[model samples]
Target: MNELPSIEQIASCVSGYDPNALPVAQAQEFIARFVTPVAAVESIALRATLGRVLAADVVSPIDVPAHDNSAMDGFALRGADLAAEGDTRLRVVGTGLAGQQFDGAAPARGECVRIMTGAVMPPGLDTVVPQEFTRSDGDVVVIPAGAVRTGDNRRLAGEDLARGEAALTAGRLIRPADLGLAASLGRAELPVRRRLRVAFFSTGDELRSIGEPLDAGCVYDSNRYTIHGMLARLGVDAIDMGVVRDDPAALEAAFRAAADCADAVITSGGVSVGEADYTKQTMAKLGEVAFWRIAMRPGRPMAIGRIHAAGPGSKAAVLFGLPGNPVAVMVTFYAFVRDALLRMAGAAPEPLPMLSARSAEAIRKKPGRTEYQRGRVVRGADGDWHVSLTGAQGSGILRSMSQANGLVVLRHEQGSVAAGERVDVMPFDGLV
Candidate 1:
C-alpha cells in the first residue's frame, strides 16, 4: 500500500502556491478542485421554488400581459380627438376591468371608452384620459384639459417580454420577484436543481448530542447543528451523521456511511496531527488526504480529502475536516464548502459581493497570514461607509460572529491598516 502524504508534502505538490493567498482566491481554487456538477431534476411549484438554482433557462411561452391593456384608471380615446382639447366630450361606449375583456369595437369619432387599471383597451382606442383629468356626466366623459397621444397609457402586448424569449437564464438563483415573473409567463411549475445531499458530523469523545445528559468535560455538539442550519439557508438537504467518538473504527464506520449516501461529508475536528486524532489514521486507511493547513488565521488546520471506495462497488465522497473551534469551523465552511456545494448544484459561481469602506480603527496582522476580522459597517448620513471591529478575534469566540454584519478582509502581504485606509468589506447576511 502507498503511504499517505504529510500535510506539507501534499501542499508542496501544488508548485508556486502561496499559503498566504486571500480567502477569495483560495476559495475559488478550492471549489474548482473538489466539487463536480450533478445531473438532477425536480418538479416544483412556483411558490416553493424561490432560492432554488434553475436547471434550465426559463422561456416565456406567452407574451407578458398577453394583450393591450390600460396602464392606469382612465378613459381610452383616439389621440386625434384631443388635437385641440377644449372639453372634448365623448360618449362612454363601455367599461373595462382587469381580467374582463371589452368585446365591442371602439367608440366612433368624438367618442371614448372608460377603462380601469389593468383593463384591456377596447379595439381601435389608442389613448387614455385619466379619470382625474376628465369628468363623467351620465353617459358621457368630458376631457377638460389633459392631452395624450396615440399609444399613451396603453401597455402593448409583449412589451415586458416577448413570446419564446429567454426570460431567465440557467444557473440563476430564483428570488421572490423572479417567482412573480414566472407567474406572469403562466408557469405553474419550474425546473430546478435537486437539493444537494450533504452528510456532516462532529467528531470528538468529549462532545455530546443536544438534549442528552452532559458528563464532565463534555460539551453539546453545537457545530453539527450550526453547519446544518447554514446548509439549510443554502437550500441543501443535509444529513446529520451524529457524533463520532475518537475511536478509529467508529470514525471509519461513520465516514463509510456518509460516503455511501451523501455527495460530500463534512466533519468538525480530528484532522489535526495529534495522538487523539483518529480522523487522520482512518483517512489513511480508507482514502487519501489532498491538502491541509491553509495558512489563514483562525482556520489554519483545515483539511480537504477524498474517501476512496470502501469496497468494489463503493464510490468516492469529498470530505472537509474543519477546525474544532466554533468560529473557525463556521468560517472554514463558508470559505470552502459553501461554494463547492453551490457548484455541485449547478449554481452560477459568483464572487461574494464586496464593498469598500474606511476603517474606523487601525488593524494589525502578521505579514504571513490572511485574516478575516468580524466587523460592523454603517453608512453615515454623508453616504460614506465606515467599519469597526466587533470585539476579540479569537477563533472560539462565536459571539463576535453574531455581532458582526460584515468581514473586514486583510490581504496576506498588507501590513497594519491606518484608521482611514480603504478596506474590503463583505456582508455576512447574503453569504451562504
Candidate 2:
C-alpha cells in the first residue's frame, strides 16, 4: 500500500538522460516505477488457483506431516540398540502402513517394527534402516551396523512446514507445487488477485483478419495472433479487438473501448516516425503519450501512456504502442510489456536469470544499441552448449522468432562478437 515515486522524481534520478534516445535499462526502470499492483482479491477453490496471484500470505495452520513419519519402507528402532561394529538381531513386533500406525505401546527393548513409507514413527524410535539393508526371517529382522544414524530416514514433525509459519507469501503467482502444498495444509480454497484484463489490436490498412480473403498488397495480421498467444502465457483475460484501419476515428473508438473495460491496452504499429499513421494523433487525443526511440535493435520506436475514457468517473488504462514489424512487436512485448503486465497483475517483481553459452558463429553489431538476436542453442559433444543465430535478424523476419529457443542478449556497450565467445541468453521455455 506504499505510494510509488512520481515519474518526474524517477526521471530526475537518471544521469545523462535523453527522452529522445532512452537506454533500455532506464526505460525499464521508468515503466517499473509507474506500476501499482491491482488490489481486487477473490477466494476460489484450491485447484482453480493455479496461475493466479496470491492475495494474502498463507500461514500453515498445522505441521506439514502432522507427525513424525518414516521416509522409507524400513525397520524402525531405537538407534542406541544397534551394535556399533556388528549386526543387531531383533524381533519385529508389528507392521505400520502409511495411513495406519502400530496400535499397541512402543516395541519392547531389543525389538523393532516394520514401517512403510509415510507411516508414523513408533514411540521411542528415532531411526529407520531401509528394507534393502535388512534381512528378515519370520518375526526376526537383522539390521546391519552403521546402516543409518539417529534421525536418518525419519521425517520429524513440521520438517517441511511448521505450524503458524508463512507457507506462501502474498504477490506470489501460484504454481502446481504451491497448490499441492496448500492442499497438504488442509486448505480447500485460496485467495488470489483477479486476473488482469488486456485488450489489444493491430492497426494497418494492409492487415487482414484470418477469415478475410488476402489481397495482392495486403498480409494476414499475424501480430495479433502472436500477441494473443503471448498474453495467454501471462494468464491475462485477453480481449482481442480485431485490426483497426489506419483512420483517426476508428483508432479513437478502439482506444476508448479498450480503456473503458481493460486494465491495459496494447497496440502494434503506427508508433514509428515513418509510419506517420493516425495512431499517434488518435492516442494523443485520448491521453498523454510519449514516443521514444530506444537504443535497441529490432525494436527502437515505442509509445507509452495512460488512456482515459471519455466520460467522468472512468478508470484509465495503461497503453503500450509497439512497432509494426512482426519480430519487433514480439521483442518489445517481451522486453517491456511482459514485466509491466506482471506487476499490474499483483505479482511481485522477479527478474529472469540470464544463462551463459558459447556463440557458434561470429555476429555483427554496433557498440551503441542493445541487440537481442534470436538463437537456437545446442549442446556439443564436448559437453558444452553453443548458440547459433537464426538465419535472419531482420525485424520483419517472423520465422527467426519462431525457430529460436532463446534470445542472445548483447549489452548496450558490447561490440561485435567472435565465434565461440561467451554470451548471455534468455531462454523461452522455463519458469519465469
Candidate 3:
C-alpha cells in the first residue's frame, strides 16, 4: 500500500467536517474520497472471472458473425423483384444450410434460394422473407406485399460486434453476460484485479463462539456469521479471526495480526464510549484513525481510518470499527463497509437503488438522523407496493432483520411519516 494522507487532513477537505455529528451522506462521501483501490492485475481463465473486476479493456479479435448471414429460415431474394402492392411469386432454385456454402449458381431475377437461420447469404441476394409468412407450392414461394422488406431477416457482418472493437471496458465488474461476450470474441482468459482480502472479528468479553460452553452473562456471537455472509456476497476473500476478548493486550494483538495479513480489518464493538473503549484506544495508538458518531439510527459510532503493524516491511490496512449490536453490525456494513471494499477492489462502486413505496402505518423519527426500518413490501389489491414493519425497530433484533425483505430508508432532515405516505426502500433480494 502507498502512503496516504493523515486522517485529520482528509477530514479537513470534507464540507462541515464534524466527527461528532456527521451526516450519513457526508460520511459516505468522505470514505469514497479517501479510499484507494488496488492496482495489481492477473490473467485468469474465463470461467473463473465471474464477479471479478476487469483490469484492462477486452478488444474483439474478430467480427462476431464473420460474414453476412440469414437471421431466419426463409427464401433469400432481391428487394426490387417484389411487386408494388400485391404478392410476388418466385422460384426456389437451391438450399443454403448453416455452415455449408451454396454450390449452385447464384439466384438471378425472379429466382430465390431457400435459406435457414445462421446460413450464409448467397451471392446477389440481400433480403429474406420468412417461410411461415409465405405460401409454398413445389419449387415456388409467394411473398406477400408489405410482409417482406429489404434487409429484413438479414444479419450483416460485424452486426453484433466489429473486429478490433472494445467488448468490455476496464474497471467493470464482470458478470455472466460479459463472460459470453468475451467468449464470442475468442478470449480464453481475462485480465482482472486481484481479489481483496478482508479480515474481520468481533470484540466483547461476553461474546463466545458456537460450540463453546454458554457461561453466565455470555451470548453466542452472531455478528461474525452475518459479516462473513455479507463479505461472501460481495466476492471478497474473507478471513474470520473469531472473537477477541476485551483485554488490552489481546485486542492489540488481534488488530496487529489482522493488519499484517489483510488489506482491511473490521472489528465490531469497543467503538462506542464507556466500558468498551479498549479497542478504540488500541486502534488510535497503532494508526491515524478517526472515531465518528454518524447521525444515523441503529448504527451511530464508527471508527474509520488506516492501521499499520509495528515491524519492518509493514503495510497499512484500512480499518472499520463498527457498533456492538447484532442488527447494527449488518446495517453499518451495508451503509458503509460494502462500498469501501468495492472501491478497494478496483471496481466501479454503485450504490444500491432505493424504490418508492407506501408506508402501512405512521412511524416516529427525528429530523436530524436517518433510520432504516426492516419492512415487508407486497403488492396490494390495488397493484401498488405497500410496506409494513417487521416488528420492533431495536438495534439488537436480528430476527426482524431476517424476516424483512427490504429496508425502508428514512432520510436525514425529515421528521415523522404518516400512513399511506410515499417513502424510499432498499431491497435485499440479491444483496443477502
| Local distance difference test, each candidate | 0.80, 0.89, 0.91
Provide the lDDT at 249 for model 1: 81
At residue 38, candidate 3 shows an lDDT of: 83
Regions of model 1 farther than 4 Å from truth? 1-15, 18-24, 84-91, 136-150, 211-218, 273-276, 366-369, 379-384, 430-432
Candidate number that wins on lDDT, 1 or 2: 2
Best by lDDT: 3
lDDT score for candidate 3 against the true structure? 0.91
Predictions ranked by TM-score, top down?
3, 2, 1
Clashes of each: 0, 0, 0
Measured by TM-score, the strongest candidate is: 3
Query: How high is each candidate's TM-score?
Result: 0.85, 0.95, 0.96
- Candidate 2's residue-wise lDDT over 142-184, tens digit each? 8888788877999999989999999999999999999999988
How accurate locally is residue 130 in candidate 3, as Cα lDDT from 0 to 100? Answer: 92
Q: What tens digits encode model 1's per-residue C-alpha lDDT throughout 266-354?
A: 88988665547787788667775544667577777766777854853368777787888888887787777788888878887788798
RMSD of 1: 4.4
User: How much is 273 displaced in model 3, in angstroms?
Assistant: 2.5
After superposition, which runs of candidate 2 have C-alpha atoms over 4 Å from their true positions? 1-9, 311-313, 430-432
Ranking by lDDT: 3, 2, 1
